[model samples]
Target: MKLKICLGLLMLTLGGCSSLGVEPWQKQHFAREDMALNHEKLDLSLDDHIYFSKEGSSGGRAFAGGGCGCN
Candidate 1:
């Protein structure tokens, strides 16, 4: 029936998500500097500071500073 087909499809879709992330052995490759989200750490930090100063919110990647732009 249509209900059974829908249930099977839903189960199939949900099951596919289990394989969607980095495996244990793949962590080393993903942790490499070349694989970093932002290749330039200094530029990324400057951008983060600008974002925090504009949005009045902070706290990410161990950065500790206020939004007053005092540095």
Candidate 2:
């Protein structure tokens, strides 16, 4: 009961998703190697450290998130 309510509250607080409707050619520029979220791997490590310390999330080379531990 309490857990269910807490889960619902958490989901509601997370906000809804958005879609850019991007296409293949439209993503060409964003596909560049240097356009990655971690082009030099330095920010990747820093982000991972922050995430681990605050959210307990960990992953590599992927966009993952669904309220799961692997996210």
Candidate 3:
């Protein structure tokens, strides 16, 4: 019984990992414009400009604007 349970668990783990990666045929779907990380360059640039203007600081930070915006 122990051997059967271990084998079942191992098979389940392996089966779960077998489909973890993207297949070659699915590359076309993943390469679509809607799937991009930054889909709109112009809008992203404009947002970056607004963020910089409001926060008065550049990258390397996470929290919203409130303090002197140093660092």
Candidate 4:
């Protein structure tokens, strides 16, 4: 049915995305300290804060929320 068609298309798409085997040295330019997952701590903190206030969930916020009406 529709599910089978979707699954087959997804499989074909993923199969075509396979890499052609690049050596470690060839990828050295992509492996840098400044190109890290989190290059700035302050920007990450702001994103977390926005997620917490909007989603009613908070963690890694340095302090726990009080058991009150505030989210």
> How high is the CA lDDT of each candidate model?
0.78, 0.66, 0.71, 0.69
What residue pairs are clashing in model 3? none
Q: Is candidate 1 or 2 superior in lDDT?
A: 1
Taking the tens digit of each residue's C-alpha lDDT, what string does model 4 give over 4-59? 99999999988876745587789785688778766786887676666666776676
| RMSD of each predicted structure | 8.5, 9.4, 10.2, 6.5
What's each prediction's TM-score?
0.40, 0.34, 0.46, 0.45
For model 1, state the Cα shift of residue 69 in Å.
3.7
Q: By lDDT, highest first, what's the ranking?
A: 1, 3, 4, 2
Model 1's alpha-carbon lDDT is 0.78
Q: Write the per-residue lDDT of candidate 3 for residues 1-71, one digit (tens) a residue.
A: 99999999999999999979887987997789987867786886666657777665555433443434433
Better of 2 and 4 by lDDT: 4
Candidate 2 runs further than 4 Å off? 1-18, 43-71
Q: What is the lDDT for 66 in model 2?
A: 45
lDDT of 2: 0.66
Which clashing pairs does model 1 show? none
Off by over 4 Å in 1: 1-28, 36-39, 67-71
From the highest TM-score down, the ranking of the candidates is: 3, 4, 1, 2
Looking at model 2, residue 60 earns an lDDT score of 57
